[model samples]
Target: MSPTVLPAACEVLVIGAGPAGSACARTLAQAGREVLLVDQHEFPREKVCGDGLIPDAHAALRALGVYDEVMDRAFRAQHVRCVAPRGGHVDVPGTLAVLPRRELDDIVCRAAREAGARFAAPWRFVAPLLDGERVVGARLKGPDGEHEVQARWVVLATGASVPPLVAAGVCERRAPSGVALRGYVHHPELAQTLRELQIVWHPRLSGGYGWIFPGPGGVFNVGAGLTGSHATEAGGRASMRDVNLRQMLEAFASVHAPAAELLERGELRGDWKGAPLRCSLGGARWSRPGLLVTGEAAGSTYAFSGEGIGKALETGLLAAAALLEGGDDAAVRARHEAALAGLKPRFALYEKASHVNHRPWLADLVVWRARRSPRILRRMSAVLEERQNPGRLLSWRGITKLMFE
Candidate 1:
């Protein structure tokens, strides 16, 4: 069979119309590049997420030019409830935003379109169209027919989805090495009670926390994640859902009656979307080619917080800037790596701290200590807010002062 012919040309072709993809397309298009953004699903597509935009994410949205809309449509809050079974609580207050992925992605896509990006949603990426050794574009299969798009550059923002090129072996898909499950739920009490995001820690789900983020109307987003190693060691004898949620409720119920009741009555919104957590600070081996993978596809998520939105936005911005630098793929890659360097150590430490958190008792103790001490709570809040790195707490002086003073 004859191969499909490539489109005349374009400067950039972006796969996946999520936050990272649309951000890249918008940036490239604003720079006068002929950009084509494609996604398998149409507008208002649903994405599995906590649906809460951390404070850092709010800043990123502003830079992406949709802060106003996001603010208008999102749930405004000022604190995160950290409930750990070890028996203490930490309440850190700061401005945060929550909006369903549907609305958030739609707003970003529309902004990309308004910025001159041509979008082709409901278009499946069949494969990457390579020019010699360089990734030039992609072969897309849509309702109309199969077509090839040739471009000077390609941005793979397919998130967890394997891009055709990656699936075809031209690039490697970095497996999470850790598994996670996220879902939505609805309950009037959960909705009214959850004025802010809640993070519940249980001993059964070490290295992962169950999260409940309020959604539109009276719904809530709830989910859990656990390291694959821990999950396996837990015997693989039963399901994580039962083990984790049970642990979650036990730790949260008495202190948070509303949360407990919501769990008892709330309907799990949709099918659980399970995926692996990619904690690759070394970046992807295949990302150095003309093709670049941003967001979770590149494993840029912070292992500790599961906060990918900010890093994804930052990576997309870096990709756009690197492309504008007029350098080869290696040059673009170096810049990308350098951009993420500052965030690597903090993420690594987060992962370490997170693992120690398996003992909800320990987490509760720390939270309890923090609650009793205002200064400690302030410092901890600073760490959670990303104002101070957790690794900084490793210093002897810092550790002693935090514990004693």
Candidate 2:
């Protein structure tokens, strides 16, 4: 068979080439498993994101052996500067980095290919192939035509896009979650003087925040996100409402001082792009017979923060580890399900906090306090570094004492 041709079958079929899919495929391939990894777009493609890699995300990449490569090309950010409206701000220390998704996605994917996973980019997944309710593989639309491929197990990691999940009945229906808009901006300050990632708490974007992450080549990733809890209800149904995310993004920049300061002198690289963030913090169905869903397709994004990459990479590694445990199909499925369950406490806590965070004033208060008090600032840093429980921020004391005191 010619190189680049899709094989009829493999031991594992991994969809998506982003961090989650690539990581899973790399781990499986390194473990002596035949793997087929596919993505709809070619490498180095645009992915709308804040591009901020926190401690959890960095740890996952480091474990996968591609963290240093990304760091070599990324802008190293040591602290996160959280700004409240009306000029209140606090700087929390952490190990964060910014690398555009194009480069970040391609780098990890290259690692996967080097590990012996057969990769086929520019190929789209049409639907999952099923044998009496068990997924065998998926139908991939390649350059030639639609081709059916079979595998012993499938790891669905298609980030962002949800059609494949819906088509396979993996996800029946979901409520409106969150929406975000992001774009690259060219500003000389990024290279000249800017040093930290700026996270702004604004009253305009309910249950969300605006961010400015320094990037390479004099450009930085800037964006805003809004949770569905505050989005307008059209006929009282969130699914039917049309969210003008671009407008929300623009509004944030115009009001937030730090963001506006940069926008005043910098230029947006291209038109604003946006995507829907599905937060399945309430225990969405993630695994089925012969199929395990990773990444955004499984609703892995953290509520309010919209942090998915960390969770995605974590789940991807968990999926591979479960299969590597050496067991039959049923045992493998059970292991994967249990591994995923371990992450639910944090997800559930974040979900609960996100609801109370719908009150933007609370964000303003936290940011204000963090800036004024050193102890609170250190505590905030602990939360960012994952050393403290975020669920506490959702408690009654968190809502009243933390916000008011």
Candidate 3:
């Protein structure tokens, strides 16, 4: 239920209670700060995501003190099968699991509340409350009515939703970095057969890839993503691609036999859904005077793999740490910006590797080589664990090395 009363003031006001916002609120509240966590949707609401958790996500969950709780409920997997266009595949081993965002996010949000953060839902951020250029709070609308709440610091963690960032004057690019569509299928037989997280690349879904991840019970997450849908043209204008994701999914099934069988034999549990993605940390300013942006709002998703949950949680923790440092506004902003800058180089590498999504033959080559060379397979596993730079495996230098080695 929505909170009947909204606090007039808080030490920290976190908007958008996804992984990022909830992580921030949890950290701040655990530090004894008065935190108010608000979201436009209520708890356990459905969120579109691949729901694959890798090693980084595991680390973040451990830090948040909810690792065991999440692991207990998540569908565990040992490997991710990367399939090339020609049906070649390589299994990269890692610590992996899958739990729907509806469940995963609710657990994190509940952790925040348990840490003493005041939680409220169905409260939409209307605008930023500013004293000149510094954000003082936000005007929120809920079932009760529209109301203004004050806070020393405001955090924007709204994932892929641009309006809140625009209202707060932090949005840099109006266009999303990419787009994706996904749906769940409930077939116990299919789920039992698909033990690994499967990623498929094909020319038909250029600038993106298709994934079939096994979820708890009989559900399997199936979808395709287009990372180049909003590529910026040479003339500085956004070049929008007119592509139908539903058709793309159909094409994926046509080309990939497992996907075809899944669709043909399994029962789709819900309508297919799509969501915009912000990637490579390029679409927004990380912070201003009194506001900070984290999560997909700040482009936390990786361009190559479209994974953002771990980074979103990590960025949220960074935001909370900057506030906990107890410095002047400039100092706090500087710290947060530096933290994001540290991750920029890694995001750039992923962006470089995303070229494989557009040129899928590269994936086929890599998979073929990986199947032949144990060294290449080890590097691929490192890439998934984030131990090695993705460029080391996807760049021209990497490709040349793969051929000779």
Candidate 4:
């Protein structure tokens, strides 16, 4: 009998070394899959973010075996102090931990490497290698020119870089809604209040809010998020929106929270970096044939509070599990979607309620009442902690009464 040669290709090829990609690669490699993880940057890369992790995020990291390690290095935020534009403060119950995304990404990537995944950094993925009509792997370009990797499965964790794939007719972005600008800053004076994460809801900024998160040593991460449509609506007056954010935080610190000076000396690390937030509101495809996009690349970030890290980890884990099952491309897609079906309503509700043109009054009222009522504050915290859905706390009926009725 003729000798048979087993295939030499990898079991999985994961692109992007961010939390989602690294988490998926680590999970799959731990399960004994031959995984190759690739990224455009080397370890310790920085990502613009709020730098605070919700309780749910902690739970997700626990499953990946790096939760305890990361938490040890993280600064714990035990309360969420919120400032309102109408002159009130609310301290929501619960704890949010702070750790720079750079540290978190490196930890997760190292975990994946320890679990037997091959690492390919500083290699930009130029395109997916197509076998006729099927995606077999990817082609990457870097200092060494170009190289192709072959794998049974390809997972795209390339947050917001989805346009290149869409242009190549590999993936599609739907309900394309908004853009988000995020940057990192260092403020030493913000240390004493590092125990709490502050979110400011300014009425002047209709669809966006400001955040002040404390990392290790009281370094504050201050940023503002607004919808792209809102920016366009401002018609070159968008700078005024951020201006409102700055002025509001200054006033709040001077009177309500003396720690507001954390933001007073806020310095922009660089020009605001933004990415399009594609919404997966109902009927969005999770995967197609040979490729699967997870995390923000898949539009999995929660639309309401703009939470993505936890959901990205969850979806990444699920995507890895599906690829490990050893099925055809169609079967892999089915498993991925089924795993995420439970979260559809959460994503849908957030996308619906968080529109730039809708429900600003209702949202403000909710925040206002929560500031006045401790019970409401706790409920809001619970919702953010993902102990229960926010829907359970304020129903459509209650929201109506709170705002209008």
Candidate 5:
């Protein structure tokens, strides 16, 4: 594939070479379409995340033909253990995997390059090029200087970032839906504990939670996060920046049964890092003439669990399919929006579940019930497998089963 310089145009221009962008770019290029993928950062750049991929994410990787490469470098997680504030817990086993985002993202992006997408890195998107209300392409800034690259269509995969959407006037500039702080930990028992993926909930963290996930090579991804709207949902008055995630993590690790056990067994391996977990629930318009939003920009992250990687790739592929549906730009936009709308109800319930997770009492009851009932435990396991919908928490039978189990 020949390279298209910044000043040139292509059939498709995908901004932000993350999972969503790469997925879209790869799909387009593999179909013999002209695609140019741009990113401000080079490969192997750091991206803060839990780094755990559930079964659904694996399916996405398989579709992209990178699952084997990923699995070769990842740790296959065995059990998912959820801990409640009252020390009640449930441990269910499943097929999950963990790999640092820095590595996994690079692999996915490179797959795009190999599949024939022209990739340009360290090229920052400065603004949108609009002809009337249509986004013709983007004005990008890089070492060569500012220039415009026109495209038949523009796809935004700029996760949790606002400037791209703001520049396009697709939505008002705002922050990500939530915040997450993560870091690596080296533990003597990390290798053994890699069998269990732990999610810890605490009363103090009404709108947030802590996690201890074992990674490959004696390191684990240990962290905590609070939804940006957590305070508002919890009826607290704390500012977004005012909360110390590291401190909260320390508190949970020192007291919570699951977190404390890991802390006692491991040593903090590096500096505690964090990032914003942008949500899909906001009022952001997903599509306009010649432009569409996928990935985190489309609020693809599940509000309750902060699980997005699967949804990110899902939306990317969905957008790609819409492009191939052979419609005008307006018809394409409608196709993508309608497909994404199917997830809105689930996303809303996930947000409500995030709110409910903040309530220690209800969370404890659910955990306590699941811990005892084999049937509920099986269903819990199914949720991780995507066989059961997480939104089932809103169903009457689901509620009865959860509470009465």
Candidate 6:
């Protein structure tokens, strides 16, 4: 149960109860730190996501000791079907699963609570409590009223919400890296037949892609995401493209026959929802003084695939490790920043591969090559497993090799 009265102080104040915040809280609480995890929403709240768990997410789940619990509830799959605009396709093998954020977030948060972290919800973070330039705590507004809670350290894991980052003075880019629209579809027959996760690239969804991932029961997670919106220009300037995610979803169904069949035959569950994405780790400062940023607030999502859950959890754990190392404020900040920087090169490779989202013909070429080449298929599978960089398959030299060698 949530605490009725807020504590006067704690060792760590973690904002947001998503995967990142929960992971951090659990890690710290398990280490015997006084942790308080708060979120604006209650447990099992609806979250906009693709709900697909790749290999990285699987590894993170194992690290959190929740892999068994999550897999027990997840819809397991072995491969992801990559569909090209010209109808050619390739099945990349990997350990994959799907569990909507509603259930997944609740399970992780519960794990944190089970680890002895104090969990609270429906408590919105108002602003940071400042001691000069250093963050000392936070002002939160709960059901009762606004209250202040002091802490030795603070963590921002708010996930794509800009207001809190702005309030904390860590926000760099105000615009999101991308945007996506998705809704659940209940179709028992379709779910039964669609065993593999399906990702389709089409001319209709230029600069974007659509996905149909089967979930437990008769439900399927259907969505379209556009990452080309916030592309960097020739001189390092970023530009935002005007897009209508709802219309893009419709276009996806119209162009992709499988998506059309699902939409026409399946019953739509709830309403179509949209969410913004921060990709390629390009937004927000990693840390200031006593506070550090993790998860989507630090741009943990990938530009190429829009997958973030794993990286978010990993970054959160990194934050906990930095704090656990027992250092001055500057040392902790430097540690977190260095860890994030190490991941930047991989993020850059994903960004390079995102070019396929804009020119989907490239996917057709890849599918065509993979159909005849066992080596290409192996590399593709390796990419899904995070064993190989996507650039190895999507780069110019890679394209040349695909066509000839």
Top candidate (TM-score): 3
What is the TM-score of each predicted model, taking all chains together?
0.86, 0.93, 0.98, 0.84, 0.92, 0.97
* lDDT digits (tens) for residues 1-405 of candidate 4: 001211236878888888889999999999988988888888888786666788778888999999989989998877887666565667787757888888988999999999999887777778877888778887776675777778778888877565545633545433234555555656655565455787766555556666777777656666655543323233333222343434433443554343345434655465555555545432235676688878777776766666678887878888888888867778888888788786788776666556522344455577777866776777777777776656544557657655553
Candidate 3 deviant stretches above 4 angstroms: 1-4, 233-235
Could you tell me the lDDT of residue 105 within candidate 5?
93
Ranking by lDDT: 6, 3, 5, 2, 1, 4
**Ordered list by TM-score, greatest first:** 3, 6, 2, 5, 1, 4
| Candidate that beats the other on lDDT, 5 or 6, i.e. the better one | 6
Residue 87, model 4: lDDT of: 51
Query: What's each prediction's clash count?
Result: 7, 0, 0, 1, 3, 0
Runs with alpha carbons beyond 4 Å of true place in candidate 6: 1-4, 231-240
lDDT of 6 at 102: 97
Which residue pairs clash in candidate 1? Answer: 86-360, 86-361, 86-364, 87-364, 88-364, 88-368, 184-269
Residue 317's lDDT in candidate 1:
76
C-alpha lDDT values of all predictions:
0.70, 0.79, 0.92, 0.69, 0.80, 0.92
Task: Pull out the clashing pairs in model 5.
Answer: 178-228, 206-358, 280-299
Please write out the lDDT profile of model 1 over residues 56-153, one tens digit for every residue.
Answer: 77877888888999888888878888877654567877777778889999999889999999887677888777677777777788777888777878
True-structure Cα RMSD, model 1: 4.5
lDDT string, candidate 6, 176-245, tens digits: 8899999999999877688989999998899999999999887999999999677677866777787788
Minimum summed lDDT over a 10-residue window in model 4 is located at 1-10
**For residues 1-405, what per-residue lDDT tens digits would candidate 3 score against the true structure?**
455579889989999999999999999999999999999998999999999999989999999999999999999999999999998999999999999999999999999999999999889999999999999999999888899999999999998998998999998888888889999998898776789999999999887899999999979999999986885788677866988999999999999987898789989987899998899988899999999999889999999999999999999998999999989899999999999999999999999999999899999899999899898889999999999999988999988988787
Q: Please, what are the lDDT tens digits per residue for candidate 2 over residues 1-405?
A: 222488899999998888889999999999999999988888878898778888989999999999999999999988988776666777889988888888988998999999999888778889889899899989888777788889999888876565777766676445546778888889876457778998776667656778888898889788888765434455653453444766667777787765776677788898678877777533246778888888777777888578788878888899899888968778988998788788878777777777644666666677766767787777778888878776676466775767567
Deviation (Å) of 178 in candidate 3: 0.7
Query: Model 5, residue 71: displacement in angstroms?
Result: 0.9
Q: Which residue runs does candidate 5 get wrong by more than 4 Å?
A: 1-7, 228-242, 257-270, 394-401
